[model samples]
Target: MLMPHPKDMRTLLSRYATARLAHAERQTLKSATQLDDVSYTLCVATATTEINDALAAADRILAQPPPAASSRP
Candidate 1:
């Protein structure tokens, strides 16, 4: 798949983080058993790491200038 622009990726990552937090909140409300709590915790941990990775990648991409186009036809 084609890579997304860093600015766009950052926006999308923010949305993803919001959605994940909402899901975690819903999961928390429904968690009545130990297994359910464990599952919710794992889900939250995974989401946190993935979101952090995406944010870091976007930051790295934004820190550099875009590559120059080749002059040759």
Candidate 2:
């Protein structure tokens, strides 16, 4: 199997983080009528936690060296 380079992984992770943040904002907006100020703040905080976790995982993956290519006959 082919492995992605660290730079590529980082780019993908960054994009994912952006998407998550946008989604969170959209959700907050959509549910604004149902949420009070404190609730909205909590929702954003939860979303941020999720985003941070994903970024941390991605960083860990990117830190590892790419697998060595196999030699073929």
Candidate 3:
């Protein structure tokens, strides 16, 4: 059996994040049209909070140092 690669895992995670961000954007737009004053405000606030959290998480992941390569014979 073949082992999974770290780069492939990272690519999958990046794709998942992108998809989630798009979904959040769509929800924000949909809520803007359908929610009343208070509800809309709450929805917008929640969406903003989620976006900020996602950004921070992504930043932290990207900031991690790359793994050192092995030097084998």
Candidate 4:
């Protein structure tokens, strides 16, 4: 899969983490909406349709020594 630019990928991943944390804490309407937005954005950035798939795609892109990297699971 095509990878996002290094800096952009970091931003996407950071947003993903924040949105996920908000979700895990509680599924409030606002947080849920934010998560949906972030998830959709992440999906688009990763060239995926589903959230899990998008996450995996992000992880894969991040795993390679992308000219850098992260630990996700």
Please list the C-alpha lDDT of all candidates, in the order they appear.
0.50, 0.49, 0.44, 0.83
Ranking by lDDT: 4, 1, 2, 3
In model 1, where do residues sit more than 4 Å from their true spots? 28-53, 66-73
* Model 3 Cα lDDT, one tens digit per residue, 1-73: 2222345335544555555566567767544444333333332433433544534444454566654566221
**Each candidate's TM vs. the true structure?**
0.40, 0.43, 0.35, 0.76
Using lDDT, give the best candidate's number. 4
Residue 3 C-alpha lDDT in model 3 = 23
lDDT of 2 by residue, 1-73 (tens): 3444555556565555555565567766634433333333332433433545545555666778665555321
Q: lDDT score, residue 66, model 1?
A: 57
What would the C-alpha RMSD of candidate 2 be, to one decimal place?
10.2
Model 3 score (lDDT): 0.44
Off by over 4 Å in 2: 28-60, 66-73
Model 4 TM: 0.76
Let me know the TM-score candidate 2 reaches against the reference structure. Answer: 0.43
Q: Evaluated with TM-score, which candidate comes out highest?
A: 4
Kindly give the stretch of ten consecutive residues in candidate 4 with the minimal lDDT sum. Answer: 64-73
What local lDDT does model 1 show for residue 39? Answer: 38
Candidate 3 least-lDDT 10 residues: 37-46
